[model samples]
Target: MRSIWNGAISFGLVSIPVKLINATESHSVSFRQIHTEDGGRIRYRKVCELEDREVGQDEIGKAYEDADGSMIPITDEDLARLPVPTARTIEIVAFVPEERVDPLQMGSAYYLAASGAPAAKPYTLLREALGRSNRVAIAKFALRGRERLGMLRVVGDAIAMHGLLWPDEVRAPEVVAPDAGVTVRDQELDLADALMATLGEIDLDDLHDEYREALEEVVAAKAAGETPPQAPEAAPPGKVLDLMAALENSVRVARESRGGETSGPAEEAEVRTLPRRGASSRWTPKETGGKKSTSTTAKKTTAKKTTAKKTAAKEADGRKATEKKPVAKKPTAKKRAAKSAQPAERSAARSTAEKATGAGKSTGERSTGAGKSTARKTASRKRSA
Candidate 1:
């Protein structure tokens, strides 16, 4: 890349001539304004608000508003005439340890290269010394007519210059955290440590910009006059209810996913601690293959068995009800009537026999009129004789 500015970095008596070029480039895809239905580009014209008509390029002038709300027109000559320094040298103010610099205060970076063969020696000297000392030089310089605070540091074999933000430029963060009553349990902490152990160190190679990649793919498809494929639906992440449980599950998933991932010596030495309340979880690193192993799948299998047993119990209870219904049906109406009537008939017959035994007379003694008339009949026969 061509150098955007020519300058020299001076610290003490040492002056290193250098040129500045941008360190990074934008990877973003740019879009154009267009008429969607007509497939035509949309052109916008500059118009004057007061005149209600198109304005020429000469009519536009940059202006700043004053306290009285009056627009003060500014020109290119007016900006150059200001007292701000437009020096070609980056003057180093102070040298401090690299950690003293806040990453948030650092802005855009530019690559600093030697201006010519003569400047190469001093450039190499500065880079080597800074690398060895593990420190950065804070400097000030004028770029594009404005003064900028900067830092010079060793990046790889070359020197990198970064623009630092002014004190007033950075906003003070306003954050409110939960009260001291919020606490992290040791079990949760242990689980988090275990999860970290399972993860080991981050690999930059695995990092990707999925959204940009998909957008590029869609753009490519549209350029080829083909229908863009639908994007895959991402599953919504579940909220964590229990910190320890979430951490344990995360560790468990991480371990399972680390099929071919080998841990470095530093990570391999990490000893995982047990989870809360019990040692029933199969998460212990030592006895993982044994019965005491911590396996999420095993837990799920246990749950399935318990559910099956409950379902079987409910089915057995239903079967018992069906089985007892037939036993109840065996007592028919005729059998019930016979069992119930036998006692009643015997009682009635016993009552009749009791009445007959109370009187010692046969059927003849029961004829009351004939027994008294027998004497009268006998007297009548004697009178006739």
Candidate 2:
């Protein structure tokens, strides 16, 4: 945090020595010029116009113009020699009611704190005195080598100093003169006050720099490669609104809505979770609700389903592994050799058995042929006799 002006609060003869001021305040907004293509920062150089050349900061000097347009150069020595009397002190010229000072006269506001090691007693004394009086101290102080008239006011427990423009420095309002034909009725004023009353509290937190926030939201959306959601359109005011009637109707509707505990999405969600329900599937809060919390609930459900699907897949794989797995045939030399020899031994035994059976069948066939030949010969001899 930078100090706006480090000057001691001096009352009577007692003086507290401190530094003068800070040039920048946190409330002041700053922007940097950037190259659109590469996002490179843009910088500026000090150039002497007459010489048509860039100049170093050390070569620069302050100057004032004379009546004849001749420049009277002021050196560092001249600036040091000038009577900057109010640099080290807040010389309270007078204490005046804060409301008497127009807000237009007030320009820059800065938080005031004691600088270069705090002097507690003097600071407390000044704060207490200002608070009790309900008045701000109007004073003159040197800042940026120029004398400025300012007001030092107490805000809450702390002091804030504000720079003020002179009376002639303020510009007049440009509003045109009112017409003599026009007049406001008392009824209209009363109705307007009624409408204002309906506006509830003036909480600054409720209202904000909406345009800036919206612009920033757009920028962020674009940066993330997304199209921003469109802002809701504002409703236009009714042409002829009955102020009291509207307020009464609003109050009535609010009361009616709050009275009956409707079957909301929350209740629906609770019902779905009950054990007696036939369906095993989990129900979302939005499903039974007339209003849609569906968008939020759907996202949550989808995430949960995705997680469940992954878990199910893992469980299935585990079950498959636990079930009987097919045994693989061995490709080792010992197993291969044993299999080969077993096949060969079975082939040799079958070959030997076939040879013995073939020999017995051949002998039976020879005997049968001989018996048939003898029977034929005997029958031929009998026929001849």
Candidate 3:
């Protein structure tokens, strides 16, 4: 890309020549009005309001408006004739820590690149000096006949120039009335800190311009001979009461929803901790019904399985009922054979339970010798029987 302006950086007598400024950070969509029937371009022309006559490019002049609404016209030739204000120099006025600058003063940012006949030593010196000092150099220069202000700082091992607005250009902060009724408790502050801690590191690239993407989509729809969809209506704000409580509840809901998205199946499967005894009252009618319905299906499932496996006729009947949505129910033949095998199964199950009990025991003596011997004797007798 071509450089927007030809310029040089100046600190004292040294000039590390560079060219580049006036780059736009954003792009605006432009539409051309056209004739509905003929599809001919509908062009606009400049017309003098007082004379009611068309004005050509030669007649146009830049005008500056005064505080009292008076206009002073300045011609292009006059603007060009004005003496260049340090055209080849970026005269530093002061050096200030970057954080001292208010965010409101920030405008556009541009990369500072060395032009032809690169002054490598001077550029390196400036970059190194700024980094060592931990300060940005504020400077004034002129471009396109308008006096411009800028800040030069070391950004990630490279020099970046950021344009800034004048203090007068920025609107003054308005006074806000204090909410005397509002007071925060230590517990609330602690919770707030915890919530903030959960919000981890900052990643600038993580953000995207959703509005611009939506607008582009709308434009594409129009181009495809479809009407653009209406924008979503804004949601009304909820009533304010117990502001901290509302905020805390909202945060919890958001965390739960987002947690469900990021959590693994194992993490989500964890059982919820129950309330302490006497901490909560018995459920009301509505709550009782809601809780009961959720448990009813689980109880029915268990009952159906028990009734099916325990009896031959019931097992057959249950299999027919479950034909629509199948479940693996134990077979009657397996159950009968399991009865003869029951003693063996019970012995195996007992041995398994004994081993499990031994493994889980805190007392080493009972678990080590006696438990194993007793378990082995019982298992052998059952097997022989």
Candidate 4:
């Protein structure tokens, strides 16, 4: 890497000469403005508003814009005369634990290399000390025409510096959190933890800039006068009506991606369907190769057996009731026939009595008539004698 700045570290009374080399680089694809019709590149020229003409780089100078809309021209000599002590030195202020440095305050990073043979010893001493103490050195240095805060720490066998923003430069995250009224449930948290475990850890070195690579492919295709490859259509996003379901699906997908084996809590967590509701909402943590899990499984098996037995008993009872229904209907039909015969017997007895009474009355009347005739014949015979 090329050195961007040359400076010395001021550690108490000792000074170590070092060179600043960028420790990171950008791999983003850059584009230039162009005329769409003619495919002509467009370039910007610095123009002086007062002269109304384009100006060269040498003719342009730095200026500060004031709140009153006035320009304050600043020259190199004026900046050099300023009372900044960290112009050519990285002055160490204090040594603090690495955790004291907030990540939000960290900015660009650079490596500090020993400038010469004499600097090698001091640089190695500082690196070893930082490594042993597990602390970073807070520092102040001037770069790009301004003084800035930095943190120096040991990186491998060498020392590196990370430019830090001033305390005032970092904004307080007052409104970044969700609404106070929103709350998370324990079940939701459990699933989230499971998902995190399923995802597990990955080596940062395995990652690459995929967007840049795709852009490069498109550019190369266009240059070769061929059709650019099309990206696969992304699945449409669905609204999260159920947070628990979303978390479960995420865990499932993560497990699938890792060949169905997940580390940590995910391995212990099991998803099962609720028998009564017929929905997969229950999360049970099963300990592998443990007596407790075995006992639980045995208990479940026993419960299932009990349920099956109960169901069978109920079915048998139902069948017995169905069989008894026909037997009960037979006696009911016999009772109905006996009740219908009583009215017919009463009617036959009444008709027989009426016929007997009529015959007796006729016989009596004949007897009375015979008696009267006999008396009359006797009286006539007596008169004739």
Best by lDDT: 4
Distance from true location, Cα of 226 in model 4, Å: 1.0
Stretches of model 4 off by over 4 angstroms after superposition: 67-70, 264-385
Candidates arranged by TM-score, highest first: 4, 1, 3, 2
| Per-residue lDDT value at 319 in model 4 | 89
lDDT of 1 by residue, 66-169 (tens): 99988889887876566644377789888899889888799999999999899989889889989998899999988775788999998999999899998788
Q: Estimate the lDDT of model 2.
A: 0.62
lDDT: the better of candidates 2 and 4? 4
In terms of TM-score, which candidate is strongest?
4
Alpha carbon deviation, residue 319, candidate 4 (Å): 21
- 53 Cα displacement, candidate 1 (Å): 7.4
Model 3 C-alpha lDDT per residue in residues 101-168, reported as the tens digit of each score:
88898878877777765677788889999999999999887666677788999877668888888888
| Candidate 3 to truth, TM | 0.56
Colliding residue pairs in candidate 3: none
In model 2, the Cα lDDT at residue 314 comes to 100
User: Per-model C-alpha lDDT, please?
Assistant: 0.72, 0.62, 0.67, 0.79
How well does candidate 2 match the true structure in TM-score terms? Answer: 0.53
Error of 3 at 202 (Å): 4.4
Clashes of each: 3, 2, 0, 0
User: Lowest summed lDDT over 10 consecutive residues: which window, candidate 4?
Assistant: 348-357
